[model samples]
Target: MADEKGENPVTVMVVDDHPMWRDGVSRDLEAAGFTVSATAEGVESARRRAAAVQPAVVLMDMNLPDGNGADATTAVLEVSPKSKVLVLSASAERDDVLDAVKAGASGYLVKSASVAELLEAVRATFDGQAVFTPGLAGLVLGEYRRMSTAPADDRAPELPRLTDRETEVLRLVAKGLSAKQIATRLSLSHRTVENHVQATLRKLQLANRVELTRYAIEQGLE
Candidate 1:
């Protein structure tokens, strides 16, 4: 996996308590031409190794020795803010999903997902898409909606000015359109669409597409 934000090949770190599962995931990622830079079995180890290696992605398991994945996720981002976490867990409980996302996870997948789905998810996560197991995505988005009950004019922070085209791009983003899909819909080049998205992100002081989408949804863009 090559990090689009940098020149070096992107590296991944696997954080899980089960050795066999961790090793198996590492091997699978490696077989898919991904670089597995480190592995950790607990919250402390995850935070420490993430600080050291600062991998591009962290394949996280919810159950760990020291603490749960949410704790580890917050700790890892504290050390390595650039890394994106994708939860690969056995649990599909609402609290687990929300906790992981709120703690800075970029995606969540149940352990039941096939290897092919996992591979595609990793690729999507690397590309900054907020991947989730089918129903989970809707649940997360609905939570965002529920959290933003107040009308934007009533409680929203003053938003920075966005160009009309940028606003259009953002609405599409809120609708879960990929950059490529947005480009096709808007009759623009993909690079141009990406540029618009990046510009929107910077102007809004957002970390990733997930935040961007939330912002858009809060503003009633979609």
Candidate 2:
């Protein structure tokens, strides 16, 4: 079932301190047909295992035994830049969520999420979509808006210019519309909408929809 890129069911790593939670998540991923590459109980172990496994997605818990998951996320990305980290934590604190995002997490999900939601989030993360629990999406966008108001840094590189349609698509993306939804709204094919999204990501040099959403907010599109 592997694709051309060798990611068939999508490889995943589960990182959580709690043994039961870790096992449960790993089982769930396996049951959902994902390849559970590894499981770790702490940030340091997670970082090391992530480097070795290079899983497509790392389901990380923010509060780990050795260190914060956010720092581990950064470390993991350093070794496996293509891997996407999705924070699965009980805490919905704004600071925690923002910290993980700044550290390069692809999404954030509270532990209260249903099994279906978790499964969908893992797939979405693999597909480059930004998955956030309920109201947290707006919070993330608001944070970006606040950050954008600050004075520009001279050292910062200029953003690449996007086409009108790309910009429109980005705006809708920042508003949390999926490609299919955007396609329906814009009277375009779903594939075309996905193409536009990919184009926007390339032009913006962004990793995924989360970063794209941040860029849109920074550009005052939100």
Candidate 3:
């Protein structure tokens, strides 16, 4: 398997200042069938290791010894443009979350997330989807809305028409339902649900589910 950038899939770099916490999370990810390819503490180390390994996903912490996750995210991506960053932090402050997103993080998850939830978020993030904790998705969306700089017309993109099934799938996707859950809800197979999702993405000209979810929210489906 490969990521959107064609990097090896499930290969991750865990970035946190705390050794024990980082090691524990690395173990959990390894147990869940992911490859913990690299580990780093603080901003500089993260930047260096990410450049060297270019892992498919970067698991970042908000507060590092040298800088915050946002700083590290920007630096790492600058060096390894193909890396996908997912902030797994203890902080949920509005500014911190916004900063990380603005710095190009694919998603944000709080430390309180279960091991299962964290693993799933990592998978979604690597899939180029916007994975956030329960309430934080809404928070980030609303914040982006408030901080919009584009003209109103530019922000309101003209959407392409979608089939009824595709529309149903899009709504579930905007609500952050996984493909499996959508399949169960609509009495369709998972592959069928994914087909609908891919069809919708093609119709909308969206690159990934992250953009698809944002478009759905703009259309009041979220």
Candidate 4:
């Protein structure tokens, strides 16, 4: 983890099949003060480079040479459980987004993302805040809401309900507050905010911060 002053550089790995996009993003991130630890063009290469670099975060393209980003995400998680994965892809189709989440991505962004937004996404992902393209956020949340309303008997009964406190935390999350910022606002410890976030995810049957952010936005938490 980097220092609280935001001057300490966070190590990052860039995974994309296109050399142009990969190199451009790497240069952008480097200019933003994040250390570019490694760059890879496919799932296999990503796995190997991730292992060698042990980056704090990874910016991955959805389509790769050897395998898709979803496959690479699973591999990277296996090798670096603590490293945050942010999917930077062009596809916003329901299946691709959901599959990437299932494979353990902390956030999702389309390739059209501006350099500023990409930098913000990386920081947000590291701080345990989920991110998604503004347009796709609704689609993802609507899908979840639709799925969340299916036959009661089809799913678990004790669908963990969010405590009021957790809902408050969710609101802050949707507003792009980092865990530390949320804690400060709530007058709680940072770890407490993180705990609420985890508990909220469990209750909502969501995968990570990205999903949580989408849901919160749909529910007008922001």
- The candidate that achieves the highest TM-score relative to the unseen native structure: 2
Model 1 clash tally? 0
lDDT of candidate 3 over 66-178, digit per residue (tens): 98999999999999988889999999987887788778887889999999899888988887777888887677656666656667766755558888899889878866888
Better model by lDDT: candidate 3 vs candidate 4: 3
Tens digit per residue, CA lDDT, model 2, 16-107: 99999999989888987899999988877987898899999999999987888898899889988999899999999888888898898888
Considering only N, C-alpha and C atoms within 3 Å, which residue pairs clash in candidate 3? none
Candidate 1 lDDT over 1-222, as tens digits, reads 555655666689999999999999999999887899999999999999999999989999999988899999999999999888999999998788888977988889999999999988888787877777877766765666676786767676767999999999997886667989999999999999999999999999998897886566456564
Kindly list the per-residue Cα lDDT of model 4 for residues 41-153, writing each as its tens digit: 99999899888888889998889978899999999988888888999998888778777877878778998888889998898787766777875655655666677677888
lDDT for every model? 0.86, 0.85, 0.85, 0.82
- The predictions' CA RMSDs to the true structure, in order, are 3.4, 2.9, 4.2, 4.6
Q: Least accurate stretch of 10 residues (summed lDDT) in model 4?
A: 213-222
* Candidate 1 vs 4: which has more lDDT: 1
Which candidate wins on lDDT? 1
lDDT of 4: 0.82
